[model samples]
Target: MSTHSRTARSGDRAASALAYGVVGLGLAFLAIPLAITCLMALDARTFLGPLPPPALSLHWFERLASRADILSSLRTSLVLAVLTTILSVSIGTAAAVGLARGDFPGKATLTSAFLSPLIVPPVVIGFGLLLFLSKAGITNGMARLLLGHVIVTVPYCIRTSLASLLGADKRLTEAAMILGATERQAFWSITIPLMKTGIITGAIFAFAISMDDVSISLFLSDPSATTLPVTLVSNMRAAFDLTIAAAAVILMAVTVLLIVVLDRLVGFDNVVGQGLFRS
Candidate 1:
């Protein structure tokens, strides 16, 4: 090759390397806070004080087990998330199936409306829910919290399930119907199974959204019933330490486990590919 051509190729390679370095640095910066939180969970005497932990110990881990409120909060979060996952995934999946396959008047408008929960700010949704629920005379309890979680999680279910529905063999149901199968039988034997990955993905989204929610959660949490994130927020305001760290660690662990399990249940890459289709 000519000297000039080789020189140009070298310059292009250098630019590519520089771009990769910049992207890697950005990702590292984003991950730093999570690393700090993980480190704090290990510290014996660190909480809300500083970025770096001063001492490392497991004293706080033991303390978490003994805290009655912590246990209660865990139970509340689990129950709320489980309920939220079931409700949101079921409704969202049904809507997604309709949006993707079923033809009806106002389908476009209905699809857009169902996803509106994602576009609205949490504070707005929370306050609006608080007012509406109070007016209906069910205020300041698990019901209020559950409703808020359902609102937030439904969007995720729709988003995931819609992709799955679209990626599924669109003609499979028709094929089954042509073979003398009733619509219900066709859906049960063919359609639902084909869309299982997306439905499962939406369920994961539901759990994560419900458990990690704080802004909407804060508005509805009461003294008698508080979700885990609300409990952590309240605890931090009163006092911060390794206990909070342990709690934070547990939350992260649960989230990561859920993601892993979901991915295992359905190949994660397939879902990603399916999602890309809807957009």
Candidate 2:
């Protein structure tokens, strides 16, 4: 090879190495805190301290189970997350279908309006929901939480479903209709099947978002209906401890499990890659 070609190839190799190094550092930056929290949870020490304690034990894990408030909050979070996923996926899918297939005059404006929640701050959304719901006499904590979660999660579902539908084979639906299938039949048997991946992806996103939401849940939740994230924040304010770390470890485990399930259902690369390309 010419000296110039060799120089160019060496420069490219160096650039690739630098990019890999940066990525590795980024991953470590995110992972280290989680690892430390897990380690603290396993520490046998009576008090919270640096990781790699004198000994390791599951004492904090046992303590985590005994904490009734934490357990209740966890249950509440799970219920809200499930409800949010179902409501968001169902409503968002229908809205996405309408927005994607319809030829309405204000179609672009409506799409932007639907996705506006994504751009709005969570704290602002929570405060507005609280005020509106309160004025409407909707004081029930779980009900308020459910409404907030659905609102936030719906945007994700709509975006995902729209992306999938945009890339779907429209001719399949037409073929089904020509074969004597009614519009509803064609939708259920043809369009829905094609949109399944997007729906599932949206549901997963909704569930994860609902579970992690604290700013919105904080405004909506009451003592009896507190979510895990809200409870964790309350606990942190009251007193920071290893028991909290234990709870965090549990939450992390659950999140990891969900991600694993998501990967199995629809490879992360496929979900993100397809969305990026479609958009």
Top-TM-score candidate index: 2
lDDT tens readout by residue for model 1, 66-103: 99998998899889999999999889888888888878
TM-score of each predicted structure versus truth:
0.91, 0.95
Q: What is the lDDT of every predicted structure here?
A: 0.85, 0.91
lDDT of 1: 0.85
Q: After superposing candidate 1 on the true structure, give the runs of residues whose Cα lies further than 4 Å from its correct spot.
A: 1-7, 45-55, 274-279
TM-score: model 1 vs. ground truth: 0.91
How big is the positional error of residue 59 in model 1, measured in Å on the Cα after superposition? 1.2
